[model samples]
Target: MERVVSIDRVNNLVKKSDFISRDLSWLKFNHRVLDQARHLDRNIFERLKFMAITASNLDEFFMIRIGSLYNYIDYGKERIDYSGLRELPFRKKLLTEAQDFVRAQNEYFIKRLRPLFAENQFKIAKISDLDEDQKEKVKNYFRKTIFPMLTPMVYDSYHTFPILMNKLLIFGVVTVSQTDKKDQKKLSFIQVPQNLPRFYEIEHNGEILFVPIEEIIREHIAKLFRNIEIQSVNLFRIIRNGDFTLEESDDIEANFLEELKRKLKTRKTGRVVRIEVEETCDRWMLRILKNRWEIDEDNVFRAPEGGMIDLTGLWSIVNHTEFKDRMPDRHPQVPPLSYSEQGETDIYEVLDDRDILLHHPYNSIEPLLELLDRAADDPDVLSIKLTIYRLAKESRVTNALLRAAENGKHISVLFEVKARFDEENNMREARRLQKAGCFVIYGISSFKTHTKLMLIVRQVEEKVTRYVHMSSGNYNEDTARLYTDLGLLTTNEQVCNDVSEFFNAITGHSIPTIYRNLITAPRDMRQQLIELIRKEADNARQGKASGIVIKINSLEDRETIAELYAASQAGVKIKLIIRGICCLRPNRPGLSENIEVGSIVGDFLEHSRIYYFHNDNDPILYSGSADVMVRSFDRRIESLFLVQNSLLKQQVINILRYNLRDNVNAYIMNEDGSYTIKESTGEPPFNIHKEFYEVTLDDIQDAKLF
Candidate 1:
């Protein structure tokens, strides 16, 4: 055996009880998030937000994780889970766990949240629950707005079964046509349009009432099918497989773009992985679906004794303006450690003077956006090159690039058209830039570019300077306020030149011989990272101070996990602050006794990737978008930049220290792959998410600094 990290070897590795299944570990993260929603300590709206977040998370999980499982199971391909189970058994376990989660969520919403709705002046009511005036208004609104958008598709001997859209709330009406003497049951579906509001909101004397669109439709659905006696109206939502690989091609613009568009449609019609139905629905109808869709019994989840509840709709309530004041306030972001509390920053001048490191949500993203905005119109700027993985819908980042292109500055963008769910938006925006005379590459052939890098070439005062911005996140302003990320702004010649070369390699489709300080994936990143860990292990064995701290979104690479285990065995103290999906088992007596794993499910998404190694107390730190996952290391084109600046390095070190100390929002991973929510034991509580937002310079100085 080569001992490589792949599905082929996962069973062998797991048979030794060395790793947790990645999918199971991910579900634990979702459970931790559900715990957050269950917390009565947080305000109701905040809990609702977390509840909605869990729903959103599960949607993607079904689309990607569960969908991938079926890709093997349905195709009759051989596959084994990292947990050592064959595909069939693994799918059973995964779906059972997911079904349990869905049930728990629904029960919580119904028992806990539904009761709170009225006390908080918000009610999830039926038309019968509404007053006469409110009822009339809702009925009229539905008849006028919703009725026009819905079409009932019939299925019988004469009619074909309708194609139901994925993840949409659909009403399955079992009606018997009065015209037919046989009284044959005709199954017809009315899919709620994705664009329509989930609820029809009406205010009655300061009390906000939310009538679920399904309720409104159910009440008047009889109108859609005239002269038919409706037997039962049941609501269900199905998730279709969304995973697909684009055929690699040398010509991406003309070939891959159209292929991607066609594939996107397949998501709506692909194999149904899971079907969620209202509890107490017609069993015959459910059986019909199960047989027709070829979905197993485990795949059909029943709502918690309530009519079909799409918990994702809770987001509407979470973001509703009326309840926002009741939610936890998103405190204003303070200036970065390098920024001064003064007028608008001259980002170029600041970078020219010294490098600036940004910890997002704690530090404003305005400075970065302002950099691009200024570069758009700056006379000195000759070219702007950016690698975009995701963008805000109304992007100031896109606007700046367009302005730069129109201003005759060379605008080159590598829009990753294979960025999962964001492919449509990326393609649409990429074409806009392409039309504006900007040189746009529609991503590399097979590897998805996940690097976040921007290079602005400026010639000022007869001197050419390259200003580089790198980050562990997207260039989206909206997400910057909600995701905890790290970014760097620098004009250091070597670093800038390295970024230039890296950009040239990707855009020019040529591999660079060297990068001064960058470690890129699908190249030597895994090797570099393993070597770094081994170096720490050797140092520890030599009786020198050695430690490793990694903060990332996921940690599932088996090879990397093995190396970390080896380092731990060698007495290298390891602390991992992974936000989600950690397969590495920690605190195992002899295997990983020195390794500590913590997951923070908190105020903002913990999205940054920070790698730190204690080189005999001379710390080495790198931050980038790469997670310690197989996709990040072997499949995606990712890069991690070395942080050599003392202040920046010190600041990131402090970040690891804060996260490790956090009692709130932290879950300690146990040897059994379960998490224990970290709690204060007589000591005052500390939340890293809050500390990063509230701690001042003086407070930070009290901790060890560079």
Candidate 2:
């Protein structure tokens, strides 16, 4: 075990911290995700999803974060993190810490959560525990269903080891041939068919019994090895490196697709990162398997409670009818916001009346959906342009764009094919759009088009008018139903022009050199944000009620963090609601004494990025994709639109105020970067999300009645 340092020492080290690496901070955020699994208030299926999410997140972490770290280590490059602290060379130390993290996760899964699952009637039974009738059913099922798909391999001097597919679960068994005079031994293996269900349900005496598929395979091993006596059986799983590398050749487009296919194949043979073995495995069998795989002892994990190596199977258990009712239904709340009374009300006109903010899941995404739907159908609309990062599987937004294209409206869609894990989805959608007569842009070769904006040009009579919809989330209606985000529909000419130019630049039409009222990244967002913070500091020094409120997914940008620290020193009262990866340390004496940071994690994901600066005479508000991260500001394509209308600014401020006042679900972040749930007081505890939902629903209904 690595030496454990005192909390004070860690704080002292952080005091001089120049850059807190975003990767490490991100890992801490994943810990928070894991924390949700431990939360009692969350439903069982929700908890299961959280666990699956964490596992899925870690897999990506290994592919991206750890993969990047390994690249840096290989090249002997030393880079500092967002905190400006020098990162130590990645060697044994980092690997050791990673191993420790995995071990802790395993322990938490087994000791804390799995037992609770078992107690809740989600039983995982073994074959030995089966009765005569149950055993008979299992035998019949295996013979009829599993036997046909079985491909068993035996290892000897003549036979080589079979190729184990990545993330595949299999069993290694030692068998002795009864026909051999010397009782010759052979090493054999059988895969738990990926196509087969992880758990098999048997109905016995009107009670449901679930047994792992591996148990049935174990019981039927004798059939596969007809003339052998099974000496020992051990279950194991393997994780291989799955990082995809894109080539920079002249035929980049063709190369990319080819590389993607190659990656899919290479994923099975890449270096092993992790291996898991059942606890009951014999020492000799374990050694032989490890030696064959060339896996080190540190890479091996022993399953607890003789449990199955992978509990992702718990997803199947979650599907059982008994637990299904307990899961929250998040769809009904996202019904159409506008009624028949608001008939054909122009989205831009509605926003012009007041800055309308929509809370997803609780309220509805229909207003935003309606905006695009109307744009597509409106005959007067000449052109529609937008940037798509990751649309939903069945994207209404994409369908709207297709409709616009088919209506002879010139449509441009900037599809970012590099949106991690959604690469294939985006690529498929891009091809579909192209086929549907839409001019599709595959995004800039270097930077991802992460900004979410829609531009509509309409020719009404003798005049050309521009309408824009700017948002802090994707146009993905499905996620819009679950992710809390903000969208603004406006006829502001300056913002519209900037957004149009942005789409044009991304699609290789024309490079936009300057944005009039918007802050765009890889260009001016960082400097503009710093200048905004400085303005706040100046206002504070002049004795005005200077304050700043920001709600973002992350706050790991060093310059932004330092500027915030400076603003805090200048008496600017700063409140930050960061949902994830916060590097800024708040409430420290002489450093960030005036700054307070908190996070809200609930049923819906808080995905919007909103910024409010008290400008003394006139406050300024903006919302966009930028998250105060260096990469967001300097590497990726991002946009922040200045909220010009007073009513809209007030609405934005109100949302921030509500979030800050939330006590029921808010987790306050301390100066040391740790978080604690807000303790309830005597006053009615504010569930900001729920309240926002009710307020929006009431407002929409009232507007309809009026």
Candidate 3:
């Protein structure tokens, strides 16, 4: 018999169940990333890459999350968050945590990686540590190259503080005016040149020494202001508010593109949310900056120990050619369709046999690219339609679409113009598609179409066939090499018909009330998920076999969490593999004792979303682009498809099994919402990425012989 909770106990669990703040949970995720930098088991260069990634990740977090919180405080809109933290107190606590995180990151980089780099024949040398010959060379290089690009502006009666662009490093010079006999200090600033490389290499006795451009500029900053006595030159950067919400305007369809462009241009001038300065900066100088920016002490981030304010630039050092051996070898991708001596296998023919599941950074994304290439050239293919959220700078997919249009094939492309950070690139690509005589839709108003779908309508023989490719990641080829994602290719008529209706619903005014195979958001995806979870709970209550497993980037939906809690209380075993924010607190007694949660962070980001439900013996699986966040549930156009093919279902099952078994790269979440890294005692360490890479290689090799 299944254990059941009394009505009173259930009510108490509901009232007491609290969520972790999304912002704080995100920091915990980043900390796991920083833990990679602290781990001695990983390669030195790879560890450096982890530190650099964390730096880049934090930059965006401040610009969006922290910036939004400050806006709330500014407009007297202080309210309690999901975690029951008021806006003011949350900001204070979050700032302290951010400071501690930054301190820990700096300590790890300085104490742990500094000696490792020296032993590996690579060094980040300070200007003071350089020999006289190297110093002279750096001085000359700065005077000739960097000095010409700098423009120093003084802050006084005539000029106000220059509005420094977001995330740009600049020197805040505290100087004594030479014109005044008394020692009077004035403030001046100069932005570091963006075009110059962040790391400058000096070859001494065949040993490579990496030097930061900022140090070179700092040593020569005094020369820029010859008339002033340079008292102190502190390096600093600012993160501005980047939370831009598009308001509904009349005639939005006509001027939406222009308005979006305007917003992008003005985003740089948003309110200053945070300021980062060197720890050695004078107290008075830091105070003046704080007062001018109107930010409190919580917004001030002092990098007392980190070598650089922005470690993202350290990618130049981490990716140097000399240290390639220290980094993990790039696994050779498995081409799904291998050319045989008899003939090249048609990709469509392969899909017709069975649905192919792709695990990225392990299995190559080339097969899907080739599928599009083949569709574009085939005379039988009538039209190509796809929704693009983000794309690489040089996107082969878009280029192929252009070629199809040029070849007299109809092409329809939906470009999401508000995909944060990639808006400009999306706009450029949309315009390029329009120029090629292809039909283009900007996006649905009040919603962003984030589904990864591509449908090709091909007329094979007397019947019309629809080919579909759906994935959990973007179509960007570059990110496919970095992010772990899943994609599916199938010629199933039911799925293709639903995809057809999906495009119509987004591009036109058609409201799809039913789908043959796919579950779509902003329509019924959330309800479908709730119903599925309820079904599992019902099974558990009936004393039938039941279990739930999900792998997603985030889980923040309250309704979903409550349903999972109910299921857990009914004796349903629940497992979650979330890569990022997970507000759901698991393993709470009488609340979620049957639930377990873990996250994996390593070389390849766990970006795929897979949901599995054990329906009495037969299991059902789904893969899609949607996370469990509220934004994805109600405001974004997303899709999740049912995986019914037995072989494909088992492949996804194995994927989850490996991630669950991972002891080295996985972190388990505690009931308090903190994560502890998984450790192997006596048991052999199993890394999911490594295991998947080797298995896929073997599968590809086996296919080659056939």
Best by lDDT: 1
**Model 3: per-residue Cα lDDT over 126-188, one tens digit each:** 898899999999999998898899998888666777888888998888888767755377888
Q: Candidate 2: misplaced stretches above 4 Å?
A: 1-19, 74-121, 153-163, 174-189, 203-207, 229-231, 244-253, 260-266, 280-298, 306-308, 320-322, 331-355, 696-706
What's the lDDT of the predicted structure labeled candidate 2?
0.74
Where is the poorest 10-residue window by lDDT in model 3? 697-706
Full-model lDDT for every candidate: 0.87, 0.74, 0.84
- As for lDDT, the candidate ahead, 1 or 2, is 1
RMSD of each: 3.7, 4.7, 6.0
Estimate TM-scores for all models: 0.95, 0.87, 0.94
Task: List ranges where model 3 is wrong by over 4 Å.
Answer: 1-17, 181-183, 249-254, 335-344, 696-706
Clashing pairs in 3: none
Clashes of 1: 0
Error of 3 at 291 (Å): 0.9
Give the least accurate 10-residue stretch of model 1, judged by summed lDDT. 1-10
Report the lDDT tens digits of candidate 2 across residue range 286-321.
777678755556557677664457657767877778
Question: Which 10 residues in a row give candidate 2 its minimum summed lDDT?
Answer: 697-706
Better of 1 and 3 by TM-score: 1
Cα error, residue 587 of model 2, in Å, equals 3.4
